[model samples]
Target chain A: DVKVTQSSRYLVKRTGEKVFLECVQDMDHENMFWYRQDPGLGLRLIYFSYDVKMKEKGDIPEGYSVSREKKERFSLILESASTNQTSMYLCASSHPSDRTYEQYFGPGTRLTVT
Target chain B: EDQVTQSPEALRLQEGESSSLNCSYTVSGLRGLFWYRQDPGKGPEFLFTLYSAGEEKEKERLKATLTKKESFLHITAPKPEDSATYLCAPHEDTGRRALTFGSGTRLQVQP
Candidate 1:
């Protein structure tokens, strides 16, 4: 089974605090992604990395940054956490040649910014 | 830009009832289409992956079929435990691995 592990399942922080959400995948997939899901808006992409240390901004990257220092790990950082950033954060990974476009996801981290 | 839309923003059905969820899309070149089932507060779980027009795939009571411009996930005799949010996405024309997702359909199967 493809396993994608997130560092935390839930977190709460104060406004303007810097936060980090970490994820690790064991499948060695080349593509890793971070998305935040909210009511009405659904799942909006924040960022994605195709390889180690390479990242691209998705539709909603503002106030968010990502780091991929190792092939198996990807981290999503909130420069300054705000109440608006409270939502379910999901991490996904997929192989480069996966024509099926199938992405395996972690359980997700629910963040609550006060 | 690739566009994917799912119909019936929400649905409710009795256990053992059968129904279908529709996904309409517009893209530059068809690469692949995906169906995912997401439970509340959890990440979406992969259900089926369909690649070309006229292709279909199935698992248990769920069957996914694709056409030139749309895809359908048919659920048969569903159970209360089968309730979930169904998501559809299109593999973009960009060689890069990025997917554009729909808002999703929230399904409730009551016993």
Candidate 2:
């Protein structure tokens, strides 16, 4: 079984504060992604990394950034938190090949930006 | 633009009620289609992946079938534990690793 773990299940941050969400996967997958879930928006990708030290912006990447310095770890960074940024953040990892387009997800981090 | 649309935004069913959720998609070329189940306050758990038309996959009481333009997830004699939000995602031919997701259909099964 694949396991993806996030640093925190819940987080609270004040406006303008910097926040970081960490994710680690045990499957040695080369693709990792960050997404935010809202009531009506479903899950929109914020950022994704195909390899260590490589990244790509997704549909809603304006307010978020990601780092993939190591193969098993990926980090999402919010330079300055805002109330509008509060949402359920999810981390997923997957193997790009072998028809493994199915991504394994973590429990998710509910971030509250106040 | 590539898109995925799921219908019957919400459904309420008795324990034994049987129904199906629809996922319609429009993409340049379909690479794959995925289904996921999500509970409140948690991330989505993968359910099925349909790679081509006329394909079908089943698990427990849930069966997924796919066509060129859409997919259907049929639930049979569902239980209370089957209540969750079902999401539909489609991978386009853009060659990117990202998937376009539908808003999802929330299912509620009462005992």
Best by TM-score: 2
For candidate 1, the lDDT comes to: 0.90
Residue-wise C-alpha lDDT for candidate 1, range A74-107, written one tens digit per residue: 9999999999999999999888676425888999
Residue-level lDDT of model 2, residues B1-111, one tens digit each, is: 547889899999999999999999988689889999999877899999999999999999999999999999999999999999999998888876678899999999999
Please write out the lDDT profile of model 1 over residues B1-111, one tens digit for every residue.
438889989999999999999999987687888889999878999888888889999999999999999999999999998999999987766764567788898999999
The fnat of each candidate, in order, is: 0.62, 0.67
DockQ, all candidates in order: 0.67, 0.75
**Candidate 1: RMSD to truth:** 1.9
How far is B102's C-alpha from truth in model 1 (Å)? 1.1
lDDT (Cα atoms) of all candidates against the true structure: 0.90, 0.92
* Residue B54 shift from truth in candidate 2, angstroms: 0.9
C-alpha positional error of residue B101 in candidate 2 after TM-score superposition, expressed in Å: 0.7
